[model samples]
Target: MKTIFFSFLFFGSLISAQNSLSFQAQLPSINLWTKIPDGPGPGGENIVSAKGSVTHVSIPKLIIHQPENPNGIAVLVISGGGYAHIESGSEGYPASEWLKSLGITAFELQYRLPEEGWATRSVPFQDAQRALRIIRKAAGKYKIDPNKIGVLGFSAGGHLAGYISSTFNTAYYKPQDDIDLISAQPNFTAMIYPVVSMLPPNNTTHSFKSLLGKDSDEKDQAKLSVEKQVNAQTPVTFLAQSEDDPISPVENSILMYQALKDHKIPAELHLFQSGGHGWGMGKKGTNTGEWTDLFLKWLKVNGIYNSDQ
Candidate 1:
C-alpha cells in the first residue's frame, strides 16, 4: 500500500492560521489530463453551484471540519450536482457542521465532473478512491481513527459512496503513492437520495449520461449500476429519500436496501412523504426532517455515534 503523508489544518482554526493548511491535490496517476480549468459556480446564499456542472476538475479539494472533542470518527462528505456541478453549499459546509456537532470530523470532497474530458464516468470514482486513501492515511494526524472513516454522500454523491463501498477492490488506476497501499473501503456509508442504478428502465438518465456518456454501451452502464455490484463485503449502510422525489426515484433506496439484506449487511432505509428531491435537510413540516435522527440512532447501534467522547 502506498503511504502518502500530508497535512491540512483543522476546521474552525483562525483564517490566518488555517489558510496554509488547506489540502487540495490531484489523484495519484493523473497520467494524461494535466491542465484543468476552474469555472465559476452558480453562487447562492452560502452555497456554490457550477452552472452545467461539467467543468474539468484540476484537483480534488478536502475541506476539513474539525470537532471540538474528537472521538476518533471521521466522515468524507461528498456533494451532488447530477454529475455536472457540486452542491457544495447545500451538502458540503452544512454537512460538515452537522458532523462536527456529533463529535465527528468531516472532510468535504470537491470531486471531478465527468464532462471535463475525463473518462466521462470513471474519473469521479477514481477520485473518490484516492480521496479515501488520503483521509485514511492522514487519520492519525487529524485525530481520527482510520478504521472509523465513513462516507456520507448526497444525491449523485450518494451513488458514489455506495459505488466505492462496493467496488473498492477494483483498481481503476495504478498506485501513485504510499496512500495507495491503504484500503479505500469506507467503514460505513450514508447515502441520501442517491442514484443507485445506471441501467435503462430505472436509470437517472441525466446523471448516467453525464457519467457514462450518451454513446456508452449498455454493458458498460450495467457495470456501474451500484445496486447490482453489492457483495457480501459491502459495509453497513444508511439511506434516506422522500417518496415524492421527482428526480431520482425512491426505488433507488429500496433496491439498495434489499440488496444489503440479501448480503446480510446491516442496513437502514427511511422514506418520507414530503421534502421533494434535493431538499438536503428538509424544511419545516416534513417527515424527512428526522432522517438524521434515524441515522444517528443507527450509528449509535453500530458503535459509530461516539457518545463516549
Candidate 2:
C-alpha cells in the first residue's frame, strides 16, 4: 500500500501558452489494486528522452493549460508512446499549446504505462476516467462547461481516448470521492493515427503487448479492441491518419469511424497522402499540419466550440 503524493511540474517547455500551466497535480486519491510500479523499463528508470518523452511513470499527473479567453470548451490531451512511455513532449505539450491558443482549456494527461508494470490492464484507463471526472467536478473553477469536455489523443493514447470514450459507463475502479460521481464520458473525441484495434494484422504489436501482455488471450484482446466496443452511446468522433502511416495502419482510424457510423454517432475521418506517423502537431510543409485547423472546424460544427464564447 504505497501512497503517491502531488509533485507539481514547472518546466517551461511542458507548460502551454506562455507559462500558463495553471495546474499540474496528481489525480487525487487514486486507489490502484496494488502498489504503483516503479520504472526500470525500456529507457531505464525514469529517463526522459531529448524529445521530451519519459520512458517510465510511477504516478500520473494532469497538467492544466488555461486559455487567455476561454470559450467554455476543454479537452483532455493524451500523448502516445506505444504504451511504453508517455510522449508529453511531442504529443501532449504541443497539442495543449495549440488548444490554448484557440481559447480551449487543455489538460495534458501523463498516464502510467502498463508494460512498465501495473497490477491491472486498466490502470491507464482508470487514470483517464479519473482525470475527466476531476475536471468535471471543478468545471466552474475552470469556467468551462462540463458537458463540453472532450478528449484528444495521439497514437496509443488515441486507443486510450477511444477506449474511455466508448466504454466510460464501465466502472474500471472503485470511487475515490464525490468527483467519481461526475460523468467520465467525453462529449467528443479526436484520435490522430491511433492504434484502435487489438485483433489481427491491423493491431500494433508493441501497443498490444504492452497493454495485454505477451500471454494475453484472444478474448481479452477482443474486449479491448475499441472498434468492437463502440456502442450507441459512444461520443462523436474525429479521426485523422496518414495513408502511409507505418506504425498504426490507416485502417485503425477507418475501423473506428465505421463503428461510430454503425452506432449512428456523428463521425469524421481525414486521410493524408504522406506524413508517415507520429507527426504530433506537424511541422512546416506537411499535410498533417492542417489537421488542427480541420479539428477546430469540426468542433465548432459539432457545437462543442463557439467562437463567440
**Which candidate number has the best TM-score?**
2
Tens-digit lDDT track of model 1 for 126-174: 7788888888888888788888999999899999999999999889677
List the global CA lDDT of all models. Answer: 0.73, 0.78
Worst 10-residue stretch by lDDT in candidate 1?
1-10
How does candidate 2 fare on TM-score? 0.85
Q: Per-residue lDDT for 123-240 in model 2, tens only? A: 7898898888877877898889988999999999999999999889898887766777889999999999999999987655578988877776778889989999999889999999
RMSD of each: 8.6, 7.7
TM-score of each: 0.82, 0.85
Error of 2 at 307 (Å): 3.5
Off by over 4 Å in 2: 1-47
Candidate 1 accuracy as TM-score: 0.82
RMSD of 2: 7.7
